[model samples]
Target: MLAALWAAEGPLGAAAVQSALGGRLARTTVTTILTRLHDKGAVSRSRVGRGFAYSPLQDSAGLTARRMRNELDKQHDRGTALARFVSQLTREDEELLRNLLGGAGDGVRGGPQPGVGDGPRP
Candidate 1:
């Protein structure tokens, strides 16, 4: 049900979601899921005539990033949190992270890279 909502290009009605789910889910079930997602800040809804059209607050990539940040914030130790994250990462992800952290072949050496700023706010 959530998959169908996520796959939709824009806000969708319950009927549209049911159709996308190939009638596997009841409209009431989809409504419940949408309500839950809305409470989680993952989805949003707007009035459309007498009913409503539901849509994601963020795209998949943005939602993933938000969830990752939320999970990291729940960890007691920042280092342990990061370590656990790195441990789960694939080789390509590890390499990319290393490069971003000033590993070999990374162009930025002493300070923040261009367009990436660090300092007190104005």
Candidate 2:
């Protein structure tokens, strides 16, 4: 449902969401999901005539940050949680991330080397 709402590019009505879901979901189910998402602070809603329109409370980036923070807070060890995250990255992702943090060609000054690249300096 969130994905449907996301693809709509803005607030969506219940019928639009149902149509986006291929009509597999009942309106009540979608409404329940929307209500739950709203309670989770993941969606915002407003009354539009007889029904409500729903939209993401935050963009993708904001949602990701909030979810990441929530996951980290749930862990007993912050360091372990971070290490597990780092371990899950593919080598290419690791390299690109390294470059971003290291400020290699990103225009920022030196921070920390990614310890992965020897590419020609930009």
The residue pairs found clashing in candidate 2 are none
**For model 1, where is the 10-residue window of minimal lDDT?**
112-121
Candidate 2 residue-wise lDDT at 38: 89
Tens digit of lDDT per residue, candidate 2, span 7-118?
Answer: 8877998889999999998999988888899899999899999999999877676788789999999999999999989788777556766777677566874333555544
Top lDDT prediction, candidate number: 2
Total backbone collisions, model 2 = 0
Each model's number of backbone clashes?
A: 0, 0
Q: What is the C-alpha lDDT profile of model 1 across 1-122, one tens digit per residue?
A: 56777788888998899899898888898878887888898988999988789988876768878888898898889898898888877665555556677654655543324433333223
User: Each model's TM-score?
Assistant: 0.73, 0.74
lDDT of each: 0.76, 0.82
Model 2's alpha-carbon lDDT is: 0.82
Off by over 4 Å in 1: 100-122
